[model samples]
Target: MSQGQHWREQLHEAAAQGDTASLLKVIRSAVAERADVGDYTLMSRLLKRIGRDEASRAGLRPVRVYIARSVTVESWLPYLAVEAAAAGFWLETKVGGYGSFAQELMSPEGALRDFNPDLVVFVTDVEDVAGGLPDACATGKPELVRAEVERGVKTMEDMLTAFRHHHRARLLVQGLCVPDPPVLGDAGDANWEASESRATQRINEQIAALCRRLGDAAFFDENRLASRFGKARWRDERMFRYCRLSIAAEFFAPYARALTHSIKVLFLPPHKVLCTDLDNTLWGGIVGEDKPSGILTGTDFPGNCYRTYQRYLKQLAARGILLAVVSKNNEKDVREAFRVRAQDLALTLDDFISLKISWQDKAVSLRELAQELSLGLDSFVLIDDDSVECEAVRQQVPGVLVIQAPREEPWRLTECVMASGAFDTLSVTAEDRARSDEYRAQAQRAQLENRAASREEFLASLQIVCRFISALEAPLSRTVQLINKTNQFNLTTRRYGTSEVESFAADPGGLALALRARDRFGDAGVIGIALCRTQDGTCTIDTLLLSCRVIGRGIESALLWYIARWAASLGANRLAGEYIPTAKNQPCADFYPRHGFRPAREAGGKQSRICYVLDLATQMPEKPAWIQTEEDLNNEPGPSCARVNEEFAR
Candidate 1:
C-alpha cells in the first residue's frame, strides 16, 4: 500500500475510536507536508465526537445547540457540531426529527423547550421558501413574486414568535440558497423584475428584514455559500429527491464551516485586537529600504492591493477592532510613511491603537501590546507575511492567532483576513464607528496625565461632563455594545443582546441609564451603562459597567453615585449590587467595597454571587468635585424614567 493510503487508514482508525489528539496530529502532519487531508466529513465527525466527550467532562462547558431544518440533515450534523468546536465551543447538540421544524417550534410542550438549547438553528432552502414561484417559461408577474416573498417571510416570523414565546434562545435562521437552473435562461441574473431568481432574492431580503425586526434573530446567508462553491456543485438533485438534503453531501463540510464562523461571532465573546506587520504585509515594500514614497501603496497593481488591504483594516478599526503595528521597521520611518509620505494611504498613524515598530521580536511586541491595551493575549490576531514571525508568535505568545498575509497578490490579503471571521460583528453601533477617534482621544488624555502636576489638577482641568440619559432616549445600539464589550470594570460581566437591552428599558420596575462623557479633550461617546431594578423601597443595581478606556478617571464612582441619587429619587431606602467573579474582572472584585456599598447577604450557593447594599436613607453617595452632571435636554427621558422620578418626588 502507498504511504498516503497508510496515513488515511490510521486517520480512519483514530476517528473511529474518538481519539481527537491523534486525529489532530495526523491533520497537522498532513498540513506540514502540504498533503491533502482527504474526506473532511470523516475528520469533522471525529471532532464532533471528541467535543461531545469533552463537554460531558467537568469544567468544559458546551454551547447547547439545536438544529431544526425542513429537510434531512442527519448526515451533516456531525460536521456542523465539529465546526462549532473549532470556533471555541463544545456542542451539546440535538437534531430535530426529520421535517419536524414546525412541530418542534410551535408545539407548546415540545422537546425543544425541554432540551433548552442556547442557540437554535432554522435551516431551509429555496424549495421551501419560494417553492410557489411560477415556472421560468411562464411569464411571471411582479405581484406574484411579491406575494411569494411575503408568504416566506410570514412563515419565518411564525417560527421566531414561537421560539421567543417559549424560550429566549438566540435564533440563527439560514436563508434560502440561490436556486439552480436559472428560470429565465441566463437573463434572470440581470432581470430583477419578473423572474424566479428575483422571487428567491425577494424572499431572502424579506427574511433579513424580519430578523432585524425581531432584533435577536440573525440571518445566515447561504446564497453566498452557493456562490462560493457554485450552485451546480453545492446542490445535488439526487439527494434532494431521495433523501431531502438541502445541500449536497460533498459540500456539507464547507457549509457547516461558514455557518460556524457566523455562529462564533454572534454568540461568543469576540476578539478585540488585530496585530499586523508593516513591511510586505500592510504595504508593498520595506519602508526603510524603499524610502517613504518608494513604498508601493496606491493606484497600481501590487500597490493598489496593499491600498485596498489597508482600507479594509481601517474599516475593521472603525468597527471596534483595535489595530496595533508590530514590525521590525524603524519607528521614525514608519510614522513618517503614514504621516507624510503615504498621502493616499487608507490607514493613518492615528488609526492604530498601539504602535510597536522596532527591530525586537514580534512575540515580545505582541505581549507588550496586549498589556498596554489591557486585553488578554488570546484577544489578538497577528497578521504577517513572514512564516518565521508567524511561527514565533504562535510558539512564544501561544494565545494569539496567526494569519499569514498573502505575498503574491496583495488584494487577496483582505480575503484571507475576512475568511478568519475574527472581526465579524453582529450589530454595528455608533461607538463602534467612533472607536478610532476615541482611541486618539485616549492618547491625548494620556499626554495630559503625564503633564499634569497631580491627579486632582488633571481631573479639574479636563472639565468633565457626565450626562445621564435614559436607555430608551439614548442610542440602544451603543448601550448594548458597551454591555457586551466592556470587561475590566464591569460589575457583573453580563452580556445582553439588543432585545434584552430594550426589554430592560421597558421594564416598569427597571431603568436603564446610559452615561455619556466628554471633557476638554473630546467626547468619549457612551462609556458607561447602569441598569437598575427597583421594587418596594429597595433598588438593585442589575448591571453597572464602564468602558476600560474611561476607567481610572473615577467614572465608576460617578456612575455609582448617580445610580444612588436616582434610586433615592425613586423612594428607595437601599441600593443593592453584586460582584460576579470572572478571570478578567479581578480589577472590579473590590469595586463594591471601594464605593459606599456595604456587604449584604450572599446569594447562590457557595457565595458564587457576592451581594452588596447601600442605605439610601442616609446621605447620597458623593460624586467627585471634578465631575459635572446634567440631564440630556435634546432627548427627553423615557416614560419609565419620568415615572420613577415622579414617584420619588411624591
Candidate 2:
C-alpha cells in the first residue's frame, strides 16, 4: 500500500482498539503528508471528524470549536484544526496568510456561515502582525498609528461580535508564542525582534478589549507557555523564519480541551449551597464561654482576617449561597453574641440559613442544618479550625468538601475559601450584595410569624412590604451581585459577567428584575432577582433564586406572580422554568410545583429535570396587601440601627 493509505489503515486499526496515542500518530502522519500535497480542505474535514468522534466517546458533546487559520505556514493549519476537531468542537477556522496584519485579514464569512461555532480561537505567530503593520506605518505619522490602532480594535470587535451574534459563541484569543531571542538571531533583520514584541503586545491588548466587550472571551497567555518550555523546542529557521508551531501545538491542544470543557460547564447550572462550621471557624475565640464582646472579630490583625472572612461569607449570602451556623455553643450565648456583640462580629445570626447552637456534636448539628434547609449533607463545605471536625465531616458526609480553616492567620481564611474555586462564578450582581441583609430580614419575619396567632395577623402585624422594582435602574450593582452570589434559590443558576448582563439587557427578549422587601424591622435592599428570556411567545425563567433568609416569607411566591403577570402583559402565551435541585437548594425543591407548575419530564433521580408551563391567559393573582408595591427601595435610606452591632451576640 502507498504511505498515505498505509497510515490511514493504521489509524483506523488504532481507533478500533481505542488507542488514542497510536491514533494520534496516524493523524499526525496524515496531516504532514497532506500538507506536502497542499490539500488543506481534506485535512480540515478529516480532523473535524476525528474531533467529533473523540468528543462523543468522551461524552463531552461539544457544540463548537474555534480554529485559527494562517495561509503562510499552511503546513501547521491541518494539525491544529484536527486537534480542535478531535476534542469535540465544531470548527470555526479563520483563513488568512502568514505575516498578514490580523486587523486587515478577513476570515471567509462562508467558512463560519454554516458551522456557526460557539468558540473562536485566534492562532498566529508574531510575524503575522508584524507583516501587516509596516505598510500601514510607512508614513510614520502619529495620526496614522492611532488610526491603525482604532482599526485593529474595531476589526477584533467586529470578528468577536459576528460569533456572538451568529452562534452566541465565546472567543478564545491565544497569545503568539515566539521563540526566545536566541533563535531569532539567525533570521531576518535583528530590529524586527523589538517590533515583533511591541506588535504582539498591541494585538494582545486589542484582543483582550474584544473579550471584555464580548463578555465571554478568554485570552490564553501562550507567551507564558513558550516561556515555560525553552524556546529551542518551537523555533525553526527554514520553514518559517519566526514561527513556533511545535510550542503552539503543545499548549494549544490542552488549551482547546480546557476551553471546550469550560463552554459545557458555562451552560449547566451550578451546584447549590455551601454549609459551614462555626466556633473558631468563623471567629477567633469559642463563643460558648468567651464573652461575646471578647470574641475575636472586627478591624484588627487576626480579628480583621476573621472579619474579612465574615464579609466574604456575607458576600456569598448575597449571591444566594445558603449560610448556616452549626456550632456546639450554648444557644443563649450564641444568640446574645448576634444580638449584642455581632455588630462588630464578622457575620450576624440573620445571615445564616439555619443556626444550630446546641451543645451537640458538629455532625449532629450539620445534619440538623441540612434538614432545616432541606438540603443533603453532601453539598456542605465543612470548614473548621479543628482538623478533627474536618475529618469527622469527611467520614460522615463522603461527598462533602471539607476545608481546614486557616489556623495560623485569620485573613488567610477567606483566601482558603475563595481558592476552592468551587464558588468561582463569572460575576457578582447587586442583589447578591443585599443577600445577607435580606436573609436577616427574613429571619426577623420568621420571628414575627412565630409570635402572631394567625398567618394574616403575623404578616399584617409585621408591617411587611414587598416592593417590586419595575424599573431597576440604579441597583445594577445589587442585580449583578445576586447573579454572582445567590445559589440556593437560583433556578437556572446561570452566573453571568457584568458585561454579559448588560448585553442581555440590550437584547430585545432579555429582562432582569430586582425585588426589595421590608417590614417593621429593616429594609432588605434588593434581595431577589428574576432573569428571563422571551422566545416563541414564551418567557423562560433563566434564573429565579432568593436569599435563604427570605425563604419562608412568601417572597418567592410574590416574585413568581410578578413574572407571570409581566409575561401576560408582554403577550406571552406560556411561562416556563426549571427546578434543578442542588445540594443546598432542597428548600426550593417543590418551589415550582407549589407555585402551580407541572412536571414535564423526569431524568430519573440524577436530575429532577422539570419544565413548567403556565398559561398567561389566566387572571394574575392580586398583589398581597402585606407585600409593598413601591418600585424603588433605594429612595428609603437604610435603618439607623444597621451599624450598631458588629460582633456575634454571645
All candidates' TM-scores? 0.87, 0.55
lDDT value, residue 358 of candidate 1: 88
Evaluate model 1: give its TM-score. Answer: 0.87
Q: What is the C-alpha lDDT of each candidate?
A: 0.76, 0.59
| Model 1 per-residue lDDT tens digits across residues 1-650 | 76567667877887777666566656544433433334445555555556555544422336788888878877777666655555556667788876678789777677898898888888876666567765432455677667777787788778777767666777888888767676766765556576666667777888878777665578899888888888787878888888888788777667877888777766655678888898898998888999888888887787889888899988887678889888998888987888775566888877778889889899889888776666778779989999888888877986688899977778799999988788777776776667667777777878998999999999898899988887655577667667866777888888787667767767766678898899987888788898888789888998999877787788778888777766665678898999988767888889888876789877766637789988877657777889887665223235535643453355
Candidate 1 least-lDDT 10 residues: 30-39
- Supply the TM-score for candidate 2: 0.55
Compared with the true structure, what per-residue lDDT tens digits does model 2 show for residues 404-470?
8878776788878764545644445554455445555655666777789998778768676766663
Which candidate number would show the highest TM-score if scored against the true structure?
Answer: 1
Clashes of each: 0, 46
